[model samples]
Target: MSDPTTQLTVLFMPESAHGPTNQCIGIGKVLLDRGHKVVFAAERSWEGKLAPLGFVEALVDLAPPDPGATDEAAGQFWIDFINETSPEFRKPTLEQLASFVQPTYQALIDGARYAEPQLKAIIEEHRPDVLVEDNVVAFPALVTSGAPFVRIVSCNPLEIRGPGIAPVFSGYAAADPSGWEPFLAEFDRTHQETWEAFNAWVQEQGAPPLPARDFVHTSEVANLYVFPEELDYTDARPLGATWHRMDSSLRETDAEWEMPDSFAARPEGAALIYLSLGSLGGADIELLQRLIDVLGTTEHRVVVSMGPRADEIRLTANMVGDAIVPQTKIIPQVDLVITHGGNNTTTESLHFGKPMIVLPLFWDQYDNAQRVDETGYGVRLSTYGFTDDELLGAVERLLADTELRARAAATGEAIRSRGGLRVGADVIERVGLDHVRGRG
Candidate 1:
């Protein structure tokens, strides 16, 4: 039981993994240890990921309503809905944005309104002293203002600046790159519009708008899971936020995973490489087949976790060698991770200190791959249909490079020594609990 005087209630909106959602879950784990009553308040999709952590969940049906829908019908509809809705917003015309921003922002505000009755009931029933939220769920900030508690924002990867680590903030509008200089100008403008919409929503609800920096700058207690020593945020004009490194204590591997039975026969000296295309992209069947064909010819043992869509690609016997395995358990045992630069996979590879051959498909994957290249730890593949010879060359270069391997190991050690889980827990505790007191 928590100390009655020190008990807190933190409401976080975690979307799902493959983005900032899982990162929030990691943040939540630390709060759980403090005996704090942390409620993961978000779309119900998050329940599967949250249940394992022993945290309580309060789901809001953010999904659109459809009466008389079957289970499969709902899944199919949502997948298509997400796919369609995603692209439209990715490149909205200024006219479209001007017309739609208010309604879209209002819908989110409505989400808070819909949530209000339930939240009010809960609060009235069991008075939580604080509400900590992800900046993505901006409406909640407006909904819970001036309560007998504090409101703190937790920014993951921290937001964009001149040049350091570019933590990709989702729902941020992309610039219309019709012209290079103008596009650059619009980047700032787009961010301003985002803040404006948020501010407009809050102001209408009787709460003060957040500082311009509040929506963009690193929070007073932000958790940058990446090792600070390894980050090159020299271009980042920081806003006095305390930067905490990732915790090593959070890295857990099951003892039963000593070695998969399939690896027992593989020649002990052969190098092993792990490949994954991440969750969203990397669905190139021909590309995957080509990789299998090339990897089979090499002395190195190759493992591929083709993701949920792996079966779509057919593989031959050589590609099926004992070397291949799913990432669920294979990552800890590999020497190199050939991946699509998804944040989670990259972070995990870094957590293990494994060098990488990053093939970013789209979105932040490119940014992540760029970070890997800039940091001198990995090489990014163009993925523009590299010929067999070109792909082979890149693979050979990475495999033979002792320096890359050493840097990766060193980076991993640095991250591991920093107490990844504990440090994260401390920062979250500070944000979720201590920040409330600091409000005074």
Candidate 2:
């Protein structure tokens, strides 16, 4: 039970992507159970979802309304953009800095500007004691809300950098610094102008300036980042006092998933693999089709997350999937995971004690792939270039390696025992309580 005087009206503003929204939901639910009032200031597309989870939904759209359309819901701007730019995924990560990275950050900056006024209105109305944002880019409205602010890095912890550490978005190996300079040079070449302009805009609006080399501002009260402890870069880069690490804040609300009959009917002892490229990566029909074709030939049954364009790809006889599925519920039941190496999936597979074949597409996906591969927690495969033999061999090799499986299981055990959700809730609640009492 929460203290009567400590009850907080907390607002969570997460990125529209499923990973950040879901991570925030995990921590929000815990705070709700502790007698705090939790509210989510999300985009209009999330209308019916958050309310059912017992949160007060404050809807805001990142793009302007269309005059003619019945549903002028603006979140589709990102989905459409990703699909249109799918060709850039084939480029080397360094080259993609100009094509994919800059454009993506530009969109985020535009979104922050568009949503600021609406967010200001919501903050005024709700008067939350604490504000939390799970995003790569910072929003000035959140920082200047006169409440304790928290930042959740649902992406790879490499987003927070140190001098000797590898650059954030580069997919460079953890053990090597050879490529760091070139990647940093490329990142700056493409990102410096936009980042500086955004930072200036933030300060002009009365918010603290963003940290150097970071697009998001670190919270002075409390900041939490999600990544399994075993795979963290603590030895190389130690964080400050305000920083806290949560293994993964997996939502506890997902309904228990029963394996479909097709998978259940597979021959005994056959390995089961879960394939998801996330909502955005899943947009690439050609890539998904290629993966489906290769996995179809295998004896093992597969469960695929078809993503936003599920209908475009037909699953093989040994597989079953829909546009949306219970990822957390299913991860525990699968023997292996083939993922796009999104932070959520990478940490989640670890939390469930499952090994992965990290097929990173872009952004920090490369960093995650390298981290897992080098740590022996998983294998990293080429997303666009993996051959049938490479895919088939990885599956066979991972399933056959008992020692690696045991190590992954052990890491999962430690992470689950740590309970990142509860820890994050505690920190958030403390920050909220302390601030309300003028102690923060």
Which candidate's TM-score is highest? Answer: 2
Which pairs of residues have clashing backbones in candidate 2? none
User: What TM-score quantifies how close candidate 1 is to the native fold?
Assistant: 0.74
After TM-score superposition, what is the CA distance of residue 8 in candidate 1 from its true location, in Å?
3.9
Model 1, residue 131: what's the lDDT? Answer: 49
Residue 242 displacement (Å), model 1:
4.2
Please list the C-alpha lDDT of all candidates, in the order they appear: 0.54, 0.88
Q: Note the residue pairs that clash in candidate 1.
A: 246-420, 247-419, 247-420, 247-421, 248-419, 248-420
Q: For model 2, what is the alpha-carbon lDDT of residue 141?
A: 92
lDDT of 1 at 437: 74
TM-score of each: 0.74, 0.96
Each prediction's RMSD to truth: 6.0, 1.8
Per-residue lDDT tens digits of candidate 2, residues 1-440? Answer: 25666679999999988889999999999999888999999877788999999999998888786675443224355458667887888898888999998998899889989999999999999999999999998889999988889999899988888876888878888778999998898888889999899999999889998887678899988999999889999888999999999998899988888997777777876889999998788877788889999999999999999977776788988898888888999999999999999998998999999999988888889999999999998789888888999999999999999999998888899999999999899888888887877844
Q: Across residues 1-440, which tens digit of lDDT does each residue of candidate 1 receive?
A: 23335656665554333345555666566666667777766665554656667667776655455576665564455445435444433342332233333344445555654564455554555445444444344544324544332223222243443423333422121222233334334444545666677667656656556666333223333534443346434345353445544533333322233454455456755667787775544345455567777777776666676544465666544334222243535777878888877666777787778878776554445556666776777877665545777766767787678888787888777776766656665555555455457555
